[model samples]
Target chain A: MRAAGKRFAGGRSHGDSRVDQFIEQIITGLSIGSILLLVAMGLSIIYGSMGIINLAHGEFVMLGAYTAWLLQSHFGLGLLASLVPIFIVVAAVGWIIERYVLSLLNNRPLDTILATWGVGIMLQQSVRLMVGSELRYVQMPPSLSDSTDVLGFSVSSYRVFLFFVAIALFAVTWLLMNRTTVGMKLRAIMQDRSVAASFGINAKRVYALTFAYGAGLAGLAGALVSPLKSVSPDMGTGYVVDAFMVVVLGGVQSLAGTVASAFFLGELSGAIAFLQNDTVAKAIVLLAIVVLIRFRPEGLFATRVRT
Target chain B: MSISRRTLMRNAAALGAFAGTGFPHIWIKNADLARAAAGEIKVGVLFSLTGTTAIIEESLNKATILAIEEINAAGGIKGSKIVPIVEDPASDPATFSEKARKLVVGDKCVSVFGSYTSASRKAVLPVFERQNNLYWYPTLYEGRECSKNVVYTGAVPNQQQDEFVPWLIKKFGKKFYLIGSNYIYPKEENNYCKKLLAKYGGEVVAEEYVPLGHSEFSSVINKIRSTQPNVIFSTVVGDSVVALHRQYRAAGLDPEKMPMASLTTSENEVAAMGGEAAAGHFTSAPYFQVHKSPENEKFVAAYRKRWGADKVTHFVSEACYFQTYLFKQAVEKLAASDITPPNIRDAVKGQETVAPQGRVRIEPENLHTWLWPKIAQAKSNGQFEILVEAKEWLKPLPYAAYPGQVCTEKGLVEKS
Candidate 1:
């Protein structure tokens, strides 16, 4: 009995070692997943309230990156200081897009998707023309650039900061959606736009604010990602595709579903990356989603609410 | 708005005649009249204007345009102004093939140039063969593919691998980690390198392949740190190269302890990676920033003047710019009465040009060029400081140097 106990203890140590390794992988996955969530949350909010896909949604992120780059290059503002004005400027741009362009496409889902796709192309090409289709440099501040030791694992400080930021944003977004009157109006409109209009809700104003809110989130995601990745005109396309997949996988109308899907997809992608090539990993994830759709028909956590 | 086909053909023929006489005024007038001409000298430029490969294509477009401008300035070929029609292709092979057909059949272009990816090139090969048009592919590709209708103006495996591998082995004593972007170019190149390294008694510590355009490299970088290789043989292309370099720096990996040698990364890539990101890296290519010849100096000066001083990098765009001049030299050598597609192809095959690198002679057998290789170190300012030149031009042995093909007569078989 003592011998068996000793063997079990040895096995437990080995299993504990593996658990430690898995924790590191999860951290990495969460870091990446958080970025996806920031981008997709904006996508979800716009689609949920306004009933538009906003294909150019990725461009908001691109613009934020460019804005950060321009600030650093021209004004010599450090990374942290640059983010301050970038948030406001990007948010303002988002508000303007909501007011002028997306507002007009309200109630026309197909037209909104096509129009936004066109706008995305135009925005991408305009950046291409201005900056010449090359990757721009976004220097990380020295303090955030280095890695920190976390229980014998080296984790990037920037990644940890990004996680905290995403969590804070998620909380604030939740409060805005659930606690505030505007939040109540948004939920009402998302539930039934015609019915909400009948109840004296200003659908137009709600849409504009919802769109702006989504765009602002995208802008924040872009700014956060700039230090981590190269800033290019076409950088947003890849992220946007992944974001769309996350949105669809999570049940587009459910914020909680979107968050769940982001972490699920992120961890799935990362774990597969460890086991196989990234392209193969992505293909497998996409295939898994396809198989899930065959069984579920309405995503993993989709609600049966009609728009 | 619809015009008759017969009228269009007649107007086209008249314009061709006017263009043939070297009368620009009459040709322009006739060109206006034959606005929908079917037999016009249609040339296709297939490039990636979007996606990951856009950086290389942007410069290639500029170089191609410069070449077209020079050709038209010199009264064009056989007095018929060369008309270049462009298509994006969007970095997709299916799109490349579709666009190739549109250029060959719909536009009736005799020849086309552009295609950075081997997949895109392979995609358009059947189209070119079916339509019997010429394709001048202008990027370094895996050797083994030899087509009758294709002219590969870029470096082959022997021109890049034979010189680069041996030099690296001699200099760094051959403990290599073969890291590359998971694609045909890197896979084939690494396969060839592994065999060559075996011949030299060198060890490849690890061989890793990452997906194209993957932004994160902490895991791969960690793997590299653990391996402790003498030198890293990298074939990572596009934006991923930047990510890898950034991770390497963040991990505090010493460049001297584990130097990197790359095949695809160049000055253009360095610029994208930024000076700090690319500092202390080494790459092997036929061209560098410090090519110090009178002709090269002139070329560099002219390039800097045209495109800003900050933008001139060792991009395929630079090669494409010179390729235009090379094409013109060949065209002038032919000086045929009717400078048609077949005539231009023959001219290009029959001639040689003194390029910025060295005297590049186009082999009639494979339609690839014989050129020199130069090793360069990435400076802090995103430019390559040319370290050593092979001096003499290395003969392009596309199939002969391939490991599997070395013993086969089929590999040595050349086109008649």
Candidate 2:
């Protein structure tokens, strides 16, 4: 025991004031919000376009994390380098699922929900069987692993990277949905599937592609967040609930609304955690969500659009 | 029931096939009983193979399998083979009870060995009692539980914190902070810690709990920094253990200044967090994979050989292994050849075994084990260097007395 004491340097408390701690919590909230934004963006697109909630969206995120883990371990790729493969692989899985199982059940809302839930379980169990149920770690790249002192607030460089990555993914997704002809077709289908089909929009193909793209975005979210936390099959379970909350609260039809709600919820929960305990913070957040939804059933920014 | 001519002819063909394959004549004779005989006994091995708790419970499952294999290889118990009927509870408490019931009722297992989380244990308690079956739980848990149908092979709070808290107070001062996952185990354990601290004239600076799997620890970490407690007594379980340790270190809080000690963190968690991440952290348990002893050495060698070189076993797994041998020894010692729930339960009372950790004895009174408590400091290699160990096995207590007798003695405590 004495020998062990020698190995440890005596603990000296860091000079962190209350104001600094508050700033740190804000940053933590923003980082968490960014993750929520990335995950919710995909959910918003899928729900808005198809009027079908993909409950297996979280499993897609789980797949992305596993893809990153596999690439990093097998190919010796950095966490950043593994992101592209993760997105592609997860998107491909999403495409196959959409083409096969989901396509047959299109327009059957209740069936879609239950089927996707089953799909989610299958995916989670499949991953657990493949990887073995143990927490796997991914290292933050050495350059991004250290903390950077910004305005007397010690900010983790990895979180800073995650914030920017979330933005970049959001921006790319925004451009893809707003500027592309495919985006136009998806929006057209969202408004009226029969009208869009009559107009030669190929609604089936558009819906499939849109769902796949949403899944890929979720995958991207998973890959980015994998380094900051332990990777496991069930890791996506927590994120999915948060993602759904963000999408619903933000207005499923509005991407900007989704972004806004994600940040709001994330920072709200984080800030509350600083003031109170985690359980209390979580309870208050849930209560707040319920009250808000009660008043604004169409969500904060829902247009009078059908979706 | 009338036997069909086709069924009789098929049975005859199967028997002829078995005879042609050179199966023993005894097997043919016992075909009507479906191979049930005095030479075979079935024990259920229940564990969470999937879900949240699988990280720890899976290790226990593997260890249980290894123990069964070892016992079977050692000429069986009085020439009677121990057949393990395995079931996956999937980490749900209700599922634990359901699967345990299935193991007993459906598979007809004489005894069941499993349950990592206390919730699961409690869930299956009624099932075991109803079925009149024995369930050997193999994990250190919050005390205040004792049952006739259950044999606890792991240390309770008394056996562990009795030695651990005093060591922390003696080495590090009385100012302590507490944190844990919001659950019965951590809540009860911390409640015990608080009483012990009060008795020892120590101050608890702060106590906090995060919901299970709440990965955001930045706020809590900030609280610990401001408080500057001498030690952070932690019972954070599951994946969050990795997050808290990583985030704590990442926040530049030196473990040397105020290290977090936990009853929950084990070798498996240390391995998950990486050696350097949780380095300087302390854990109190009856067993660590790196323990040095002839029994441990042989156990580790065999475990690694059977599992993998990369796989690491912790206290939970070790306790499960010990329970298997204890059951084997008890059953062999029984005058009767049949291994029933009542016979095994009675046989296990006061049964002693030189387990891998040390000599562990099951108390006839509470059904908990007399375990040797040890405190270990984690090294950067994901292995714990044993810092201190009990001079003798601490007696098991279902509801521990504050500042138990063994903890009152100082000379018996070793520094290194």
Candidate 3:
């Protein structure tokens, strides 16, 4: 408690400094939440439809980062321009894995976990062997490189852009799931595969497409994050753990729940970090989440679906 | 294009080998091993080549290999070529210990050179002690401990902070903001800074720690902004180094006005962060590639020639290069082919060498090298400009609490 108060009590007026630190923590929370939204959305979608726990989804993020690195290094493409290509490239790889390898272990949840874990290892090592294991850098866009002062506090424009990007991506995904034929088929298949097949919905095709789309979303997340963090082969491992928490705590099948959870976890962790040390903050967050899960085992807003 | 070029080089090497006896690459590897078994002395090269510290450790690996090549070309030590068996510890402490065991007990390496982080060094120390093997650690670290089985070729806490703190206090104001990644190195380093600040009539305004790989620095930046400290001393390593620097710049803080000082940011980090972000920051290190010495010039030329011109060298890598030469000098002092641990350790005591870092003499008392402390400023071109350098070698005091160690422009000596 003393450590927390000590940090906030600076050279500035005590109340003013505390207020500023709080506002800054909120912004940091939002920045973390946006990244979590992008990552966990894809993870939740895959888990909702396929019932497959993708341990390798984080590796997909690593792949997307590498794809962006290669494009920028080889063709002088900026971070924004490399996003679509990275999505396509990573989606195609995900599609191949789902069609040939994952299709074999569809109903076996335990096997899929081990298989994906193995795939993650393979992906990490392959990148290490090919790219030579060094931290690669992706330059931020020149336009968003500077900060914009808001109420006398300096705020990064890139972070503001990221928040907007997360909202836009979420809106697009929601529309795709609610207003389109693919969305209806995916929902039907998620609810009942046999019923969807009886209604002439191609469950197989939808499964592969949804998996690829999820992978693409992960790639997009990776591309967006590349400029902020150092891009390394093991970069995804940490994010995947955090994203899983976001998806689980948000209620795995509910997008709104995930969004809420992402913000909640981000803010809580950031605010706690502001007060306590980082390691203790992490412990408290995980402990709180664990207690939350004990009370609501299906998550905060999970729908009742009879399987 | 780089991958293809590497493939082409590999193919050409393969073709040249095949042209002689039509042997496969596997057989060629075996033949090299056979040669090593017959005449070469085996030395283990260990470094974190794949995980978080890979960026820095990979350069150290190349530096060690370059030294081996140079030594071999210079007609080998006592007519025996050195065979380096390289292994990647993958930046795990347990893996480091396991590999150290394998190198000593299994590979029969006479000496092992590696490790960047103090955690890894600590992990492998007991193994080296148990096996009666020598481990030459070549990274500047938060020092307080000395292992008889290990030879430290990098700057200790006193050697680094002694030069950095006073100069920083004089150049900047007296208030310091200390921040670091939550680990042994950073924790220890910040503690050292706290003590140094107190000694120099300076004070730490605030102290903060973030987890390793914690990319977000906005909260910490806000604190730094409000605290308005005169100097920001950072020991955040890996990706966090990039994040902190970027966020500090993005938060509208002028580097020239209230500059950041780091013990960890070398040329490797500066290049990764790009030159602009690191432009006005200060770094305390013993070696910089920009040093205009004949030894450094030759080292840079040979390294560029071997590893390509685009590749950059840093303090740790240069220290590793010097470590290998120092090892060779120690080995040369011994008679016959008795490369036993005790014999080598005894020979390395009080040994001196004119390395690329000027002059390094291993203190017999603590088994740590005496090095010249240098403070450099980062330039926009991803290089360092030496602001101040010690006039002479600073004697090794592994424990910072040790008093009566004195340094002058001419040399360093300790009072009995």
Which structure among the candidates has the greatest lDDT? 3
* Cα lDDT tens digits for candidate 2, A113-211: 667888999999999888888887776676886666555555677777877888888888778877999988887887778898999999888878988
| lDDT of each residue in A1-307, candidate 1, tens digit only | 3333233223334445455546656876887688788778888788765768788888988988888888888999877788768777767877777677767765476556667887888888899888878788888777887776655556677777877888888888889998999999988887777899999999888877777778778877887778777788988887788888888888767777788888898788777765555667778989988887778755667764432
Model 3 lDDT tens row, A169-279: 899888888789999788888777898899999888898998899899888888887777778888888889988998888876887788899989888887787676576
DockQ of each: 0.30, 0.25, 0.26
Q: What ranges in model 1 sit over 4 Å off?
A: A1-21, A192-200, A292-307, B1-44, B50-52, B68-95, B98-111, B130-132, B169-175, B225-228, B400-416
Top-scoring candidate (TM-score): 3
Task: Give the alpha carbon lDDT tens digit for every residue of B252-340 in model 1.
Answer: 56677787888888877777666776788888888775677775776677667767776664636656766666666655665444444
**Residue A72, candidate 1: C-alpha displacement in angstroms:** 2.8
How many angstroms is residue A49 displaced in model 2 relative to the true structure, after the best TM-score fit? 2.5
Docking verdict class for candidate 3: acceptable
- lDDT for predicted candidate 1 compared with the true structure: 0.74
Chain B TM-score (model 3 vs. true structure)? 0.88
- What TM-score does the predicted chain A of each candidate obtain versus native chain A? 0.89, 0.91, 0.93
Q: Per-residue alpha-carbon lDDT of model 2 for B1-416, expressed as tens digits?
A: 13344765776687578756752223122223322266787788999888898878888989999999998898888888889978888889877887887777766677899999899999999988897889999988887765778889887888779888988998988998999999888888888888899889888998888999988787787577557799999999988898888877666677887899999888888777777777999999999988988999988989999989988888999999989999998888775545678788888889999999999998887788999999999998889999998999998865664333222111112223
Better candidate number, 1 or 3, judged by lDDT: 3
lDDT for B356 in candidate 2 is 90
The Cα local distance difference test for each model comes to 0.74, 0.82, 0.82
Best by DockQ: 1
